[model samples]
Target: MDIIVEGIKQAFILLFTLDREVLGITWLSLKISGSATFLSMFIGVSVGTAVALNQFPGRRFVVSLINTGMGLPPVVVGLFVTIFLWRNGPFGFLEMLYTPTAIVIAQTVIATPIVMGISLAAIQSLPANLRLQILALGATRLQMVWILVKEARLPLLAAVMAGFGGVISEVGASMMVGGNIKGYSRVLTTATVMETGKGNFAIAMALSIILLLLAFTVNVVLTQIQQRDRPR
Candidate 1:
């Protein structure tokens, strides 16, 4: 009880003071997760749409793989990514391990499948004859795809929310790949973990509050867009 109250006070203090380190961690968390979500949106929406619209022999298997990937553990992702970026690993020549870029890469991997799976479902939920109707009106294949995407924009936006939520709250992969170095790769999630491990419950809770507030603010904006676009 006291601890929770103290934590709330700490959170308020941190916000009021605009502590440099806390602000930096918060900003880095947003930047990395935002980039990951954006990159995932591009690749995920494209691949998902292509998969949904095409008829290929191995398409189901590919979708199953993606669906499975949507639930992939962040720690496992961290392990493989860490191995890949290790000194002697395949991409070791790039020397990206323990860097902010590495965190982005790991987070992108974590978020992509989630966005892709949701995107696939959103595209598939459209009217079956919609494509035919568009083509019947002399629309090119490219234009048809564009129109279908526009029709499904609302649920696709949900994909954005889910992808951003997943990565922004993720801590294990960020810790594994980013090394949680101060002022470099440290983020709200990892910072909270470190503080908790050090028995600084109030600090940890403050970080958690900040993370929640940040996520809530972004989601509020997205939700407004989503609701505003709702069909009458």
Candidate 2:
């Protein structure tokens, strides 16, 4: 308990002092996770809208695949991306392994399925009458999709928050793909692990504090959005 209290004290001091290494790791974490979340939103929203609104051959199969992807293990994603980007793999020419970009790719892959699954559920939960009314008004397919997305905005934001939370806290993919290199690809979670392994609790505590704050802030914002969008 004394050690824990001392660690918190040191963490607060480090935070107030604006330690360069701490700030750098925080910045890199935000950059990679933010980019991953953006990419996930782009792909997930499009794919979710298509699955929710359109009917075509193999639609069920596609959605089932997405549902499966929602449960994909981060380590599996990391391994798959590592192999594909390794020297002997097809895209090995790009030589992207052990970099921030590789971490982003892995994180994005892990996040997209989550966003897709949640968005699909949100869209499907909308009132059927709203969809039928839009069709009756002769709204184009694109316009109808826009309407549904607008109605589902709150849930979509929740999906984005969830994806951001996952990627920001995940260490498996980041460590494997980014190699968790100091002063470069190291992020809060992976850094915390590395620091702890070296018996350095101060930096680890600081990083953990920052990561907790980020997750808490995102969840609070998501809750507010949900309340604002709730039916009056």
- Return the TM-score for each candidate structure: 0.97, 0.93
Q: lDDT tens string, model 1, 131-202?
A: 999999999999999999999999899998999999999999999999999999999999999999998887
Per-residue error (Å), model 1, residue 1 = 2.6
In the order shown, the candidates' Cα RMSDs to the true structure are 1.1, 1.8
**Best model per lDDT:** 1
lDDT at position 70, candidate 2: 88
Residue range with the least summed lDDT across 10 consecutive positions in model 1: 223-232
Q: Give each model's whole-structure lDDT.
A: 0.93, 0.91
Candidate 1, residue 82: how far the Cα is off, in Å: 0.5
lDDT of 1 at 69: 93
The segments of candidate 2 whose C-alpha lies over 4 angstroms from its true place after superposition are 221-232
